[model samples]
Target: MRPDEILIIDRDTVERCLAKQDPVALVESMLHHHAAGGTVLPAEGYLAWRNGVGAYTRAIAMLGGSDTSSGRTYGMKLINASVSNPGLGIERAGGFTVLFDPETARPTALVEAGFISAERTAAYTMSTLRVLGPAGFDEVSIVGCGTIARAHVRLLHRYFGAVRRIHVHDIDPERARRFASDVTGRFPEYTVDIHPDVHSCVSASQVLVTLTVSDEPYIEAGSLRPGTFVAHVSLDDLRPEVFEHAQAVYVDDLGLVCDNPRRILGALIRDGRVAVPGTSDAPGSGPGRAITGAYGDVLRGALPAVRPDDGFVVSNPFGMAVADVVMGRAVADLARAEGLGVMVDLLGAATRAGGAA
Candidate 1:
């Protein structure tokens, strides 16, 4: 296998992969990977996401099909690690879609990425919420109108059908307006409100999902009504005091949150705060649902459900590679099923690739 080879696929391939993905297996694999001394370079974490994406996306646009810019190409590299002897069909960001592994690079397989970002994030969120407590939110206030913000709404919409009303507010009025229109247009049965400002949207909400990448906290704790479940996939979007009054704080990746620039849960973890299932010790699960400071522990009957007024429940995916691998495998199967991937024709050596790894 050569190091310089690249594999590529498109969006349709990702769809097939996700259709048969398994949540439990993926989560377990990720926990094992982290627990097994796997080093993590949180993508957004390492990149310092304040304004990194805005610049990166613009560079990508200028590189692709631009008459004014130089024809020089800037291909984005896919994050990788070899579990089996095989891994990755190359996946270029934006331009070259789908997960593809060139035979030379020894990439495991090409997979679809239809819901790669959203599903994985949602899976992590749901996993934390599942262990943390009940998330039977009827109506939700969403603060932020971006990709992950929309992902939160869509995924929640799938799980909690009772979410009939969504109060969406973005600093960008146009984006907020567009989101409300788009959501209502897609799901006519549900009513969405494009709040002119944050106060009108979040003041009395049961659950507030914050997806903005704000350096300053957008939603203050005093502003939040009692029983408001505040879960910000992005921490700085909400005020630090919000965590103080949180009855329950469910973080998917505790390590990520602890290291977050916002330091929302740093003090709590530092003080070795513990949570008893039924007690209102803030539904903060870390290290295991057992409070070890590892990945969250699983709680079946051991854990009590979320009450009517659990203040905050936040889950951070932190971009675990295992989730990527799990999703990668799913995409591979879909690619194989639909006969979409380029076969590794290493003569008889190709047969040896699967025998051991």
Candidate 2:
């Protein structure tokens, strides 16, 4: 409560926190955090950029019921925000946030779902990139320019060093050029160029990053150069056949992807256009099991990268609330230890409520 108390957290500080966490560990941490009676709030929001043609705002929340006795917390998370990210080439405006707390707990500090959204979303992307090997990227293509896309460019540079010749593209040409100029003016090590067309960028990029809000697909397999890899940050960026002949379907979790893969894969399996590699025992089944056995197998070096002829390579991640809970709790602890967050006067309130349970 004293003026001497300070809350020291800046973008750089958050970046440091994020830099230290790995994607696999982040995912595992979420699983553990959930197993440790943690929770994730809900997320809902929209996206609109460069034009008044699109705009939306909505409310979304989550409820967490933690059972310390059983050492587990069973809960649900949902999105109520409907605004899509402006149709920037690389960002799809998505903003539905969830707040989490113990089964019988009082609120002392309320974290802004907006910041949490950016934090966790970046965590997932960086986590995957970290796992995939940061140096794997030699040339990078960012198709959309927005908050998250900017975050990607900044963080990737911070983590992997300047991507050789950064390529920027978007439906908004002016926005794309501005993004180049702004980011170039900000970080001088990399040369930023604005591409008037997606094809030129995609064809030359080895590591392509796309974030878009358009319901229509922004990426097409026909354009990707051979041997190039992609890190798709947006959940709904591709169409049905984008992965029609992918050599590898990399994912953070095989089970999660299997349960609810992207619309492209989800629709293909559901409509019989394509089959999930591992689950099909149906007539058209060709392989003995799925392409990659699972995350464990991939970790154990069992799953090989898709060969050149396979056509496409992909990475899918469906974030877990439990992971959000862990990072959130860690941030909360950091806030507490540093006397950062707003403190509540619990005092004898618990005593008045018949003491602590």
Candidate 3:
């Protein structure tokens, strides 16, 4: 393939490559690289509007780059979601990731990002769990039964062999049942129990993962048990009081989370309910709750892992674009090596036009 040609990796190819790759390791490397100041993560671009059917829809553009053992790579992920897509028999989220040449800053590849995005997010959750979750647990709870929930369960099954049972609760009972069926069909060694409500699921969980898209916070602090690790994937599921009472709260990035005032954690910082990390009134020093630190600190041994005494720990991963970029770059490399994906002469037309002129 020529340097000017751009490789187009479809969803199927990306999935095949990811199945053979270890996303958790990739995400861990990303966290470490980011911690070492080898990444550039700019503020994410966001836009939201209501659709014609009165359903909420939003688009996000995340730009980031990283320097790793593999090399230097930069990219942006543009993902969009509509709440009504599920009702229309379609996936709720879809997008693409574009990787650029590190030296030339020209586009090199376009990879389907919906699956990569979900997978990397799940990988991040698993990586965080290794440090913040209970040391040993057999039961885990999931609050939503959507695509993201499925990704998390798949990773848990693959990595955490101690988990034998999965407790799940969804607002729609049928969806929960479907999710359970899918899990059992793929991994028969596991047992899945569908709860009637979130309270029952939370009460039975050693680890709770929320994957809903609710605009309001519903999971109360009372529902959570001591030593429970909550992976708050979807930002707005947990109430403000939940954070206020948690043993410790870790985010992907301190500045990124506090800068975005739309999410619960950011809103708390904006409202003076939570103290930003590295400030004079850092978490635990002031009347308000304090942020423990970013996950990178834990990875780098700058912060301690969650202990048994740390009750109801929370990890708010304000999804980092660097993770997506690294994952996409890895998949692109794999595709290139295996001679997969289509290579398009993206700049050929322009080059020819210039020559004619």
Candidate 4:
């Protein structure tokens, strides 16, 4: 590729490239970089509007830069999420990432980000699971059967090794059954059961992951067994009372949790139901109160492990923008190495023709 040209990688290429990448390692490294404080990550930019069909649509622009082994890499992702796009028979999420030449501020490549988002999101959960999950879980339950659920199912198995049983439940039974069948076919050694109801699916499992889009909570506070590790992959699936059941609660970003539009945890805290670790209100609170901190603290050894007797461990992660940029850099490098995208001088040609006017 020419120095002034930019590579354009489509979604299929990104999917193919990511399949060969180790998501865990990539995200782990990204988190470490994030925690180590060298990366430049600005607050994400977001906008919401109504589409032609009156369906809600959202767009996100996340930007970040960090020094890599090769050099400093910067990237920004533009993501559009059409909440009701299922009516149109296409995936609801789509986006593209632009990696830049740090010194020249020239575009390096534009790669699709839908798969990257899914993989990195799952990777973030896996990283937290490694730090906060119980020593071992015999049976795990997944409460959603969508894109995030599939990523979680595959990564949990790949990273944690085999489990005895994986119970899956979805509002749509057909989706649950289909997910169960597909996972069963792929991993015959583990039992993949499809549950018709949420309570039964979550009640006895040692680990439970909720990945639904429910605006209201469905998982009761007392549904999970003691010592269960819960990954709140989606924000609204669990009720506020669920915090009272957590022995420890970890979040990716405390600020985001306390202020985002879907500030479920923040609402609970304001109601005096949830107690953060360092807060004055936390002390003297009764059992089932949460001791909250960032997962990075756990990784950095600033926070101790959740004891086996800690009752229930929960983590709610509001993903970081640094992750998307880091992943984009990796994809850009891979595309360059494999010669996998189209090259074009997006603005250089026009600028050169325009001269100094």
* Strongest candidate by TM-score: 3
Model 2 whole-model lDDT (C-alpha atoms): 0.52
Model 1: lDDT equals: 0.50
Q: Choose 3 or 4, whichever is better by lDDT.
A: 3
**Model 1 over residues 141-227: C-alpha lDDT tens digits?**
888776556656666666567778888888778778878888888778778877887887887466776666565665777777665
Each prediction's whole-model lDDT (CA): 0.50, 0.52, 0.88, 0.76
The best candidate by lDDT is: 3
- By summed lDDT, the worst window of 10 consecutive residues in model 3 runs over 348-357
TM agreement with the true structure for every prediction? 0.65, 0.69, 0.94, 0.87
For model 4, the superposed segments whose C-alpha errors exceed 4 Å read 1-4, 270-272, 275-277, 282-291, 307-310, 347-357
lDDT of 3 by residue, 20-114 (tens): 99999999999998988989998889899999999999999999999866899899999999999988877899999999998788888899999
Say which prediction, candidate 2 or candidate 4, comes out ahead on TM-score.
4
C-alpha root-mean-square deviation, each candidate? 11.4, 7.2, 3.9, 4.5
The full ranking of all candidates by lDDT, starting with the best, is 3, 4, 2, 1
Rank all candidate structures by their TM-score, best first, as comma-separated numbers: 3, 4, 2, 1
State how far residue 301 of model 2 sits from its true place (Å): 6.5
Model 2 quality (TM-score): 0.69
Candidate that beats the other on TM-score, 3 or 4, i.e. the better one? 3
* Residue 123, model 4: Cα distance from true site in angstroms: 1.1
Per-residue lDDT, model 1, residue 253, is: 51
